[model samples]
Target chain A: MKIFELGKAKSPWILHYNTGSCNGCDIELLAVLTPRYDVERFGMLNKGNPKQADILLITGPVTKRCRERLLNLYLQVPEPKVVVAVGTCSCGGGVFRHMYNVENGVERVIPVDVYVPGCAARPQQIIDGVVKALQILREKGRALEVPPHLKKIVRGREGGIDRESLLEDLRRR
Target chain B: MKKIKVNQEICTTIPMGSQHVALPEPVKLVFDTENEVVKRVSFDVSYVHRGIEKSLTTMYDFKKAPYVVGRICGICAIAHSIACTVALERSIGIDGEVPDRVRAVRMIGLELDRLQSHFLINGHLAEVCGYENIFMHLWRCREFILDTADMLFGNRVQYDVVCVGGVNRDIDEKTGTRISEALEEIEESIGFMEEVFTRDKTLVKRLEGLGVVSKDKAFEYGLVGPSARASGVKTDCRIEDDWGMYRDFGLEIITMTEGDALARCLVRVLECFESVRMIREALDSTSPGEEIQLRVRDNPKKDAVCRNEAPRGELFYYIRGTGKKIPGRVKIRTPTFANIPILPHVMIGVRYNDVPPLLMSFDPCLSCTGR
Candidate 1:
């Protein structure tokens, strides 16, 4: 693996966006950053800039106004990123599911990799979800290391390079 | 459109949220500043509006209103549920008939909610002011309060403990003793925090005179909770409203005359002690394993309004029933909604750097405001 991928896997910076949560999961996610949970011990830092974030932690069901902002933030994050939906509201809208203003859940707006389920997810559960997100982040990092079109060329056939297959794959690409 | 002239050469407009690191919820503030001092401010708090009031009247019936309203704001979930349940009970004509044990349990839940919410905002205030160590320490102590709530009510943020007419879960002997033990530890930590907040020169200097709200302005803007009390307004819904047994529990209202950021922080810090005392008194007043919930067969027929003191301020709930399963209307006025109007007033004259801390001092819960 490249040194950049190794460093990215070791430390994942988080960008937290609240679509329209009750402030329960948001605080618990903050609690995970504070002394008791101390997620910083694992080299994870909460970043305010979406451009610098490696993982997007979202809370609340997507509100009509926030839906656009959520998508904008999601698009701004650099690739090899993960999105973790915290709390039941973001998971499937919880109690606010059918509310007129809400879009049901975060998944309706963004692709979520990990869904932490709780009315207001506890700090422990949030930490678990983040840890799961880290694994996905590492897998995504590995996936991005080698381009899909170059796979056949990099891992050639039995004795020599498969130039024909490589050319076909290049043409297809 | 209404237009105003700006001296653009000497002033710059800065927009601070909707999504900010200092704010847990989304709220936007546009500040017009000249020479680092704010000349004016405008705000937008509609980012988190979930139409909870409409849902209460349309989506859910009166019986499920308490749980639905609890989602208005998670930090003050108990306050919303209590106020909603009390209003529902009154509309159903069972206002003062709830058992003493039930009220005690409800008080415990509400006070614990206050303790956690106060800790959260105070720690957040410190963090925004660049005092990260104090923020961590305060939040570290806050875990005890969350654990106690989890032990008593099975969930950390949304307790779902209060229901219509009574409480859903009963506080037994074991949980009561456990709560007492946790409160003792919490009190020790709070004492340490009190010393730090009162004597720490840096924190005091950073917060002392920033965002000063005069007594008249607090009344004029209709500030509630700690923000109003900090300005010597002497208003607390816990005393004015008869929903809880706070009077019997010897609840003392903490007030300060300074009305600055520091005073607001101090008011919340001191109120934590009162919450602790009330929680202890509440546990002592109630016996173990008595009646918890009371059943009611009739739907609400009349309109009733209930008010409760949330950690931030007064939380008001109005419900009108038509003798049907669902209420005809439900209106909720949260504490943050009352407290937010004063922001443009307070932020106008403060330094740009102090904006985040000053805003944090109000403990703005935009979810509550927009919902």
Candidate 2:
């Protein structure tokens, strides 16, 4: 891991966007970040703008209207960022699954690095999910850090990106 | 200073939300301003609509409907759950037979839910007013109420404790004692916050006389909950309906006549004390030996309406059941649905930067509105 990867883990500024689920998961996320649970202890800052975000925490099952806004927000966060879906609804639509207006999970629109499952995912589970996201960031940080010639070689893998060994190494980390 | 009317011809428009710092949910408000003062305003509130009507009536079973209805708004899940359950029970004609103990427990859940919600909105009002420290303080104080909820119901955000005929969780002696103790601790902080919110010159200056919705205007919008009471309308659904044991506990309606943001804040703060009083009396009077869940065997064959005082205002649910496992029609008109329309009515004369606090003062919950 690059030395800067330590800084990334220590002070990850996170951006939160709600797609359309009932606010159960969103309030839990805010509670976990408060002084009582304090997600800041893990170096998380809940930034409002996507451009400054290093990790994106999204709640809600993507709805028809929010899908475009969700995709736009995901794109706005500069790369080396990892997406964490923070509730059961965001993971696979939970109670809202098969509803007419719901588009289901965030993964249907954008890649999710971690899925935190619960009706309104608990604060402890949210902290655990966020820690997992930081590990994914460390791997992406190193891969994106390589020079243009080496980056092209890494990006040319069979799946269009090299993450096969990185997953295994992350489990160990 | 002499009164001057700015020309509307040189106005510039500004659009806020769908996603913005001041809003937690998606909503768009376009303001047509003549320089700094807003001349005209419009709102778009359909962004959070997720086909709740379909889910409530067709997708979920009649018995499981309360849990589904609970998802309408995370902050006010208990209120929705209770309202939907009562409506279903009324249509089926079995709520009168529900045990008093179950109603008492349900009241505890409602009051605790009300306490936390009042804290959430009051603190967010402070946040939008740029008083981050007070926001933190109020929310930090709110954790006590949340912990009390976790003790009684199991989770913090969505309690999911309300069922069709009764409640899901039964309170033990141990938990009941703890709940009262937690409320005592919260009461101390509530006093301090009342002092802070009342005496803080900055908050008073920012909120006073801003977003003045007159009693007539409040009635014009059909405003519900604390919003209506703040406008000098002494109406509360809890007193109007005999759903819970509020009548037995002697729950008095609280109101103010100022019809401004500060009045709304003061009304909510005073009501929190009223809620605490009810909870304390309820814990003292009710013994915990009754059955929590009643076996409700009948299905609905008629239409019924249930109204409850959500922390924000009156939450009304209309359910039509046709003796089938699925409901025939379900219509949920949330408090925010009635309250958001009042935005354009009130914001037409306020300054631009005052928009966030004014909007927050109404406690806009777009998810509740659109759903």
Highest TM-score among the candidates is held by which one? 1
Candidate 2: tens digits of C-alpha lDDT, residues A50-147 = 89899998888888899998889988998899999999889998888989988888899999999998888888999999889888898888777766
Please give each candidate's TM-score: 0.94, 0.93
- Residue pairs with backbone atoms closer than 3 Å in model 1 (clashes): B225-B313
Question: Model 1 chain B, poorest ten-residue lDDT window?
Answer: B1-10
- Give the clash count for each candidate: 1, 2
Q: Compose the digit string of candidate 1's lDDT tens values, residues A41-124.
A: 888999899999999999999999999989999999999999999999999999999889999999888889999998888888
Best model per DockQ = 1
Candidate models: Cα lDDT each: 0.88, 0.86
lDDT (Cα, 0-100) at A36 in candidate 2: 82
Please state the interface RMSD for every predicted structure, separated by commas: 0.8, 1.1
Provide the lDDT at B18 for model 2. 73
